[model samples]
Target: MDAVFVIKLSALGDLVQADGALRDIREHHRHAIITVMTTPPYLRYMQRCPWVDLVFVDPRASRFNLVALSVLRRRLHKQHIDLVYDLQQVGRTRFYKRWLFPNGSWVGDVPGCSCYLKRPKGAAAADHFAHHLRQAGVSVCHTLVGNVGWMADDVTSLMRQAELQPGFVLLIPGASAEHQEKRWPHFAELARHLLDRGYRVVTVPGPADLAVCRAIPGDMLVPDDGYYDLFVLAGLAAQARFVVGNDTGPTHIAAHLRKPGLALFGGHVSALSTGLQHTCFSWLEADDLHKLPFAKVWQQVEQLMGKDF
Candidate 1:
């Protein structure tokens, strides 16, 4: 194919998981112009991906916007794409085949496609994703590609301004607000413990995390208006001695970069699918984030770091 398009428009964690598929696509068509369609929030990070050559941001104006779909159709038609990889095998993407971009070699569950992935019964999400690529004739391998470097200079600038050194511990204390169960309660305490142990703990706080940020000890570093985008976070994380985070996007970024850390997953998330496949990473969890005490998580962090903190 001269031109290939991939669609995975939302959910930051899932987008990170699609790294392997993107890598497979790159390997499958080395010279093809690979474009990805994603939501506005993820476009910047997706643009950072080395496999994709271009990015299309879906405004997602509203639910079922026919006008927007028409504009999108016209826009995609301009690309003369030879293949469309629907990584998001949902009803919305199915609509793209049934309605908008109706004529194309789309590799998805939809009919009239070059290939289809009949998801194996009881397959894990990661397995299902990989299976989809393999069924679509793309070579699936264990390569990850999440590198936009959107703020390399900014990360360095901000770190230098803060007088922060490398090897500090990064703590991500927030999760999707809709899933309150995913937010762990002991991060502040963990920060305290790490601070007492002489490890600098830093966290970039969202508005939802202000309370958690304030609850931590004064020693913990919280960036003021740093605008820590994914690449910047990845850059800082790359230098960190350890990263501890809730099962959220940054945790996935850390996992993608294979950072040694503890991903605190609650019972709500499937560890097998979302857990970092790299051995350097580990996870600790309980029935819920509220129930998962600090000690259990600390033990896992120690194990990940290969020493007592």
Candidate 2:
């Protein structure tokens, strides 16, 4: 059996976006042993994915740390990988290509590699993944239409535990802590509007988002342990009638789940570049989120909800 390694590191949104490419890779190399190298945070989440055979954690130690680098090298040597796909085409991956897998058959942005995936200028992330996979002899049907259905657990019990019905609107009012500007300031107001319209509103907060998410007027969904992990969040997103969130991981998951949703974007990033916008999952971009009035978003929500609400 052929040994294949795919390297994709941090950021939950990026991981969620790569689901299509990952599934395509699995189909293309059906007989190969595919292993995905990701960070510790996503180890368990990726393990739940049916596309890959194995999931490995990369500590992401500095290049200067010879001991850690040597350990990583030793681990790679043990696998005898026949091919490598560096999905995370960053400086660290480039270094790994140059030093660790110097003579290996590699695919990505590295110079003189077996297959170099040169991203087209102004291409969206999903489009780029499709283009690269096509170059690697893999058909790219699912690259843009990624699904997270496999990642969803049985959330029925949890829904009853939270006293949520089947048709609640999911409000993800938080973004990455570092990018506070991406978060629209009117989610609380939006929640009020949704509630007043006789819609059941619920919010799922990650570990860091509790304080901000709780401030929004809605049913806060949490596990028995008082924490909502990625898997549980995926389950909730799959069941949500409509999702409204900032450009964050849960929003990406909800978008990939093919839920009718809206992803709010600010000056930090465009919805086009992120590829979070789908047929059902629309996006509204504002140059400055703070200045974005609640009325405009509500109008979009009304349109998004249609006669269902």
Candidate 3:
């Protein structure tokens, strides 16, 4: 393929999960000019992505807007895209297939496309990514081993400025606003114990999480001026000795980076479905997070520490 397009948009955690899939695509089509059609929230990160050669903002405006659709069609046609990988695999992307690239070479769940790979109901995201790629004749090594090594920025100066050092235990005490139940209520208590044990606790909160994170006892890693971007968040997780957090985007980054950590989850989703757990990255699930106590989570932390305590 001379030109290719991969569709993935929105939500920070899902984008991080697609790291492995993106790498596999780039490696398989090394000679092709690969582009990612994403939303504005992820435009900056996609521009820095090592795998894709181009990034296009999918306006994702109302499908009924003829002017917007016309502009998108014209731009995509200019690329002369030879193949499209619809990783998004949602209603919006299916609409794109039917409207913009009606007959062009397309690969995804959409029926009647050049290549159709249906995701099994209730299949894990990582597994589904690998399955479809292998079905499409691409080697599927990295899709199951999500890696964000390339997405990190050097935080030496930032670390110094923040009066923190590497190897400190990282704590993520907040979840997305809509999923407040996902936030375990014991981080403050847990941080106190870590502090007593002489472990430096650190937290890097997103814009929406500053208030919640600041209340937790830790060396808060925020820009003195504005905010922390994806690279810096990955960098913090990359350098952390151990991570303890709710199931949020930063915790997913920690897991994929192969950091030794504990991700707490409620009954909303299973850890297996997210595929974020590993030998080093462990999880503890409860039917209700509010009832999950700090003692149990602390025990998991001690276990992650490998009897060094």
Global lDDT of each model?
0.74, 0.87, 0.87
Candidate 1 per-residue lDDT, tens place, 1-309, comes to 499889898798888777777778888999999999898888777777778899988776554677887787789889998998888787788877777666778888786667777555444546776767777676767433333233233467767877888888988888877988888888878887878888888886666776777787633344565445566677777778888888898787776766678788788856766636533567776787898877888877766676555
Candidate 3 residue lDDT tens string, 1-309: 589899999667788888889999999999999999999989988898889999999988899999989998999999899999998899999999999999898888999998898877767778888988998888998888888788788988988887787889999888888998898988888898999999899988887789977888978877778888878888888888999989888888888888888999999989887877432588999999999988899898898787765
Error of 2 at 226 (Å): 2.6
TM-score of 3: 0.96
Instruction: Give candidate 3's error at residue 309 in angstroms.
Output: 2.4
- Candidate 2 lDDT at 87 equals 81
Which pairs clash in the backbone of model 2? none
Q: Give the worst 10-residue stretch by lDDT in candidate 1.
A: 144-153
Candidate number of the best TM-score? 2
- Extract clashing residue pairs from model 3: none
Order of quality (TM-score): 2, 3, 1
Error of 2 at 135 (Å): 0.9
- Per-prediction count of colliding residue pairs? 1, 0, 0
Residue 122, model 1: lDDT of: 42
